[model samples]
Target: MRFKPHFEKIRFIFGAIVVVTISGCFQIFGSGPATFIKKSFNPSKTKQAILFWKGGNATSGNSLQVSIKGAGDDLDKAEVGNVFTVDDDHGKARLNPKAIRLIWKSDRQLNIEYDVNLRTFIQLKRFNDDTIVYRTFKPVIPANHMD
Candidate 1:
């Protein structure tokens, strides 16, 4: 499945919940006739555990191979303690910073904080083995930025 970048970038859109269940009903008769039947598929046959990466909806196993572009505009996966460059080059000066300390807030959420002469921010989702699966990146400001 292809993932399209979100307008706001990598935001989880928890939309309506659609449950699809398929079960059958059986009828039984007493003294007049004997109708013995077995019924299965009672519980929901569909898996409802779903995740969204850049507007692409996938189940737990459906997005096992998903990928996304990093803040450096390079498509990569975020693992623990991984550092990468996000330096910027202006006409006069250049700012070099590294994105590090990849932490998984949850099984499906990740928070990556970086720097560039100042601290920056990036967030993504993890599908399998804590791999980032969403795109769209910008400098994430902290609670205080004047320091």
Candidate 2:
């Protein structure tokens, strides 16, 4: 007897839903999933930031990392205890005046905010998928200065 293609497709979809539901249930009940989801969606409110230095290439690293430049006249003089938020559609980083740095090797695009600086970058990878793998660095500079 021959099986119908439609039946196979339905079976595949049903199996996938079962797998997802099982995982979601586990996540809902465990701290691991809760913490993972929290961090994944809201990284900007938890990570720390450091100063930025040139000479770092984005193409030669396992993960893309972002750092704030602290030498600019306006940025260097900003209050030391200030805080900022950095985010992409996929994740976010919460940073304080210490300066914000992030390494996103699995994200394609990101939106970062530091003090008054907001910038975005497109991560480059080997696939046509929307999952970009890149890092972005933003500083507490004026909007006009961002490129």
Candidate 3:
């Protein structure tokens, strides 16, 4: 009777809902913890040093923090705004609006790194790929430290 039609309709809607719900859950919780890989820099003809922290471990709920250190000169006084570039391996450098901190540590070399969620970096729309590239001008180390 008419009961068959009603049952079919209900089943279709239920199936659709289940499919959508599962897909959403995968998008939300599928990605696991973020893994940060350290990149090494070589002092060569390149005045600016570029390092990238892979975003495989990045999720959709955290902010990307860029920390700079080992600059013998106070970065606050230097033109540091346009100093670095973050790309996605596709030739795009995105900027993070979060606070950038400059600290002076007695380290042998300059190191800069950041932790950012995939969602935050994706908002920039600068990268069509998944990886995020960070490029910065060579940290101004003391001449005495130069090899």
Candidate 4:
């Protein structure tokens, strides 16, 4: 059966609305769901580091994030952190989830260790009066071959 002109226009508009609505949902929810990994507090219990992984789409890999905030602040509310990404192979990320670690070496220092190969997006050396120390067990390699 053939569709009437007005009916075809209505169907097209409805399809457009559905596409926009779904895309809006994705934007509201971010790339994908985030999973909490670990948290560590300084010796003085004043600041804390929260670790999490955020899923990514086909073009981008999963992300490992470490946020530093006041000890009492909520993890979701923490705004300052470092972000690292790894290749996304189909649905799997090229990172070993267990290879990441966070430790408080001192009241003013936070130690972060992850796979040396992951690409770092944001690396904050200092936050407020605290210092963030990042390290990988093995020698480091540049993220981009430009080096």
Candidate 5:
């Protein structure tokens, strides 16, 4: 009877440690909530483009993800079809809708424009049948010079 109480305490401590470890892993690996930034439809309105910001912890920083989906696809059910990732060292200045511009030149062509300083982690030249083109202002300073 005396040993039973001690065993129960040990089990509780072990369970708590396991839970804390799992939660810490999630914080390190998983991103925080995604905030919708902007959306645009193709000229034909058959397909849609979405831009959102996925918040991250201090280690991961914030990221901008661009996705394409059907016009009628549910925003909640659709996974983030991340075609481009703007990795500006987790800078949140570009979280606004105006920060990233998306212009559909035609049903098959898309023009994306953003700051030249922002490094693109993933830049797809094409998404499905749409040809993607990126435009940026000439960097006055070399990329390596930027802190």
Candidate 6:
């Protein structure tokens, strides 16, 4: 009867040790929640406008929405069929289409078809480029008109 009580006590202690060892291993070896880890590793692949027209009239084709892709946003917004450019970065600047008269990048230039009065014009092609270089004036016949 004495040996019976000792055996029960040993059995209880051995079972408790096994349970605690298994539990400790789980806590030490397991990573954080699987979902949270996966979410942090992979980001959403959404197409956001790296450069977008915050304000532009798309109906008249005054300004175009240029993107990383060769294709641009088909928003037609313009006033008097004119768009202005400026040296200001991240700020709105007035553009005079008459100032340059013709601007192009590569073979792609501003394709504007205008009536004699200059009331309205349709843009047949858009100047799509990542960078633009301007030429200084050298005195032309009409001035401000590039030949």
Candidate maximizing TM-score: 5
TM-score of each: 0.20, 0.21, 0.30, 0.66, 0.78, 0.25
Q: What tens digits encode model 6's per-residue C-alpha lDDT throughout 1-147?
A: 699999999999999999999988765654322110000000222211122222332222222222222233232322111232222122222223332323332333332221122222222233333233334342223323454
Q: Which lDDT value does model 5 have at 7?
A: 100
Please list the residue runs of candidate 6 whose C-alpha ends up more than 4 Å from where it truly belongs after superposition.
Answer: 34-147
By lDDT, highest first, what's the ranking? 5, 4, 3, 2, 6, 1
- Tens digit of per-residue lDDT, candidate 1, span 1-147: 245666334443322111112111111111112111111111232111211111111221111111222322322222111222222222111222222223344444444443333221223344334444333234455323454
Determine the C-alpha RMSD for candidate 6 after optimal superposition of all C-alphas: 22.7
Judging by lDDT, tell me the better candidate of 1 and 3. Answer: 3
The residue pairs in collision within model 3 are 34-57, 86-93, 87-133
Q: Best by lDDT, which number?
A: 5
| Candidate 1: C-alpha lDDT | 0.26
Total residue pair clashes for candidate 6: 8
Model 6 residue 126 CA deviation (Å) reads 35
Error of 3 at 45 (Å): 16
lDDT of 2 at 99: 33
Q: Look at candidate 6 and tell me the lDDT of residue 86.
A: 23
lDDT by candidate, in order shown: 0.26, 0.32, 0.33, 0.68, 0.73, 0.30
Question: Between candidates 5 and 6, which one is better according to lDDT?
Answer: 5
Better of 1 and 2 by TM-score: 2
